[model samples]
Target: MYVVVLIVVVVVVVVVVVVVVVVVVVVVIVVHVVAAAVVVVVVVVVGVVVVVVVVVVVVVVVVVVVVVVVVVVLVVVVVVSAAAVVVLVVLVVVVVVVVVVVVVVVVLVVVVVVAAAAVSSPCDHASSSSSSSSSSSSSSSSSSFSSSSTSSSSFFLSFSFFFFFSSSLISPPFSSSSYQSVLIVVVVVVVVVVVVVVVVVVVVIVVVVVEVVVVVVVVVVAVVVLVVASVIVASVIVAAVVVVVVAVVVVVVVVVVVVVVVVVIVVLVVVVAVVVVVLVNFEAFNANYKIYALAF
Candidate 1:
């Protein structure tokens, strides 16, 4: 009975732990799903920001061109100087490119920060272990993974910003030939940044899916083991109960048989004693009668 009770207690504990792990896993899955939604929202916001930045750049360019052209025309009215017009146009284009580059960088930084935050958020690592030490180890590993991913993302963002800023500063001056070149470079940088962001998002998503899959698989295996253990425990308990009952029955039968034999032996001894007494008494009476007859 004691062994059965202990087994039952153990089964209950294991069941409770399994339930807790299941709840944790469900929570983790929900968190990951929310992260995914957050990523989508970030992407959409980034796109809108990019559009706004482009519009701002275009408006700035048109305004600068119109202002410079007007100044040049007024100068033509005063004293015609084609060289001054050319210089003014080149200066205006350079200023516009600089503004556009700054706006793009700021937008890209926003995107990077948002993406990094999503990746770095603590993921619930609900690992079931037969021991506390193993559980702690799994938790540490998960934390380390999150930290590494976060650091790598930060490094990538910094490197991208440095590259864009440095290349812009070192590139040729803004002129008719270099204008298209600079614009191409800026577009390329933007595209690369967007692609990198997308890739990181994909990697984070895959990690979440894999983690959830592993949790599910572990839960299934634990359940199967628990069921098997319970079955074995039940069988052992039943066998123990049967053996105990059989032993008690055998002991009772032996005790009754011993009591019956003792009773029978006492009865036989009493009957023998009584019969001998009656025979003795009758013999004595016959002896007396014979004597009396002789006297008569």
Candidate 2:
């Protein structure tokens, strides 16, 4: 009966676990679908924003173009109205006179600019022949030359309000109508020349610095090689000197040993000769005494 009850409890637990897993799987699928929907909504909203921005830019550009066209048309209409009124009242519109005067002035300045630019090329530092030409022009600026410079100066003086009164020493109004433009050109040329000179100087300095560095590197390498060579030569000379010193010491030691051996042999020979002489003298005395006794 106990084994039967255990089997029934295990079956019930297994069924509960399977039902919980199925519910969890269904919930996960629903969450995934909802997340996908939210992503699609966000993408649609971004596309709508981009389209709205494009529409606003187009509308603004059209409005600005329309405003500009309206302003231009209004100006034309007002100018035409003023000119018509003037023509009816005065028989000749003052606007036409002003336009003619401006056209004439512009044509004159254009002609002068062309003539001056063509005829007056700057002091040709490039040519060796220009100096003589410049000198002749200066010399001919004498008391009575009806040169263009003086005539143009007089003409400008009468037209302008200031040159008519100022003395030459005080100040002269520029004679050429293009005097301001000429001054600007001269200033620009001078600036360019100065810049060129400065750049050349900097380049020369950089080249010199590089050359100095190269020379220093070469000298350092030479010094290191010489030092190494000197070290090798000194070691060879020292080894030779040590070898010679050792040989001389060995020769001196051998000569001293031979002299000690000779001194020892001479001392031994002297001792043996003294001992033999004493023995011979003693034997002769004994024999003489014996013969004397027999004769008596």
Q: Summarize candidate 2's per-residue lDDT along 1-296 as a digit string, tens digits.
A: 12122222322332333233223323332332333233233333333343455575754454354345434433543454344333323322232343344335434543454444433332122122433444466576764543544554444434332322332222122335334543343333333323332332333233323333332343233233322432334334433443344334334433443343333334323432433343234335435544664588
Best by lDDT: 1
Q: List per-prediction Cα lDDT, in the order shown.
A: 0.39, 0.36
RMSD to true structure for each model, in Å: 52.4, 60.8
lDDT digits (tens) for residues 200-287 of candidate 1 = 2333334334544443343333233322432334334433443444344334433443443344334433433443454344345546
Checking candidate 2 for backbone clashes, the offending pairs are none
> Which parts of model 2 are misplaced by more than 4 Å?
1-163, 167-177, 230-296
Give the runs in model 1 whose Cα sits over 4 Å from its true position.
1-173, 231-296
TM-score of each: 0.22, 0.22
